[model samples]
Target: MEDSEKNIELKINQISQKLKEIRLSKGYTSYETFAFENELNRVQYWRIESGKNITLKTLLKVLEIHQISLEDFFRNL
Candidate 1:
């Protein structure tokens, strides 16, 4: 893969990791439970947490659900 592709994959992984961290901090050990409680599609949320298909809009929605600003979300990343 190209360097750009590798970087993109790395970023996706980081985002997925961050999402998991947020969920855990929120007292959710299961992604399915988190998705169900948040009214999100479980399968879609799984794919997102797996870093398979994450869009900016979806990310924004998740961040909004957690009441986190884009700046704060990416700050540690």
Candidate 2:
């Protein structure tokens, strides 16, 4: 892959790991539980947390459910 593509993939992996960590730290035992509490399906939540090319709207919804602002999310990274 191109250097840029490789970098993007690295970022996605990092983000996915961080998302999982944060969710677990917040006492979410399972992805399904988190999804249900956030009003999303398990599959959809999995895709988002896995950095699977989800839409910005869905990303925003996920962050919103976690009570995290977009700015804070980026700032913390």
**Candidate 2 per-residue C-alpha lDDT over 1-77 given as tens digits, one digit per residue, 9 for 90 to 100:** 99999998888777777777778989998999999987897998898778887677887787787788888777766
lDDT of 2: 0.82
For candidate 2, the 10 contiguous residues with the lowest summed lDDT are 13-22
Please provide, for model 1 over 1-77, each residue's C-alpha lDDT reduced to its tens digit, 9 standing for 90 to 100: 99999999999999999999999999999999989999999999999999989989999999999999999999979
For every candidate in turn, the CA RMSD to the true structure comes to: 0.7, 1.4
Q: Estimate candidate 1's alpha-carbon lDDT, on a 0 to 1 scale.
A: 0.94
Task: Assess every candidate by TM-score.
Answer: 0.96, 0.86
Query: What does the lDDT read for residue 59 in candidate 2?
Result: 71
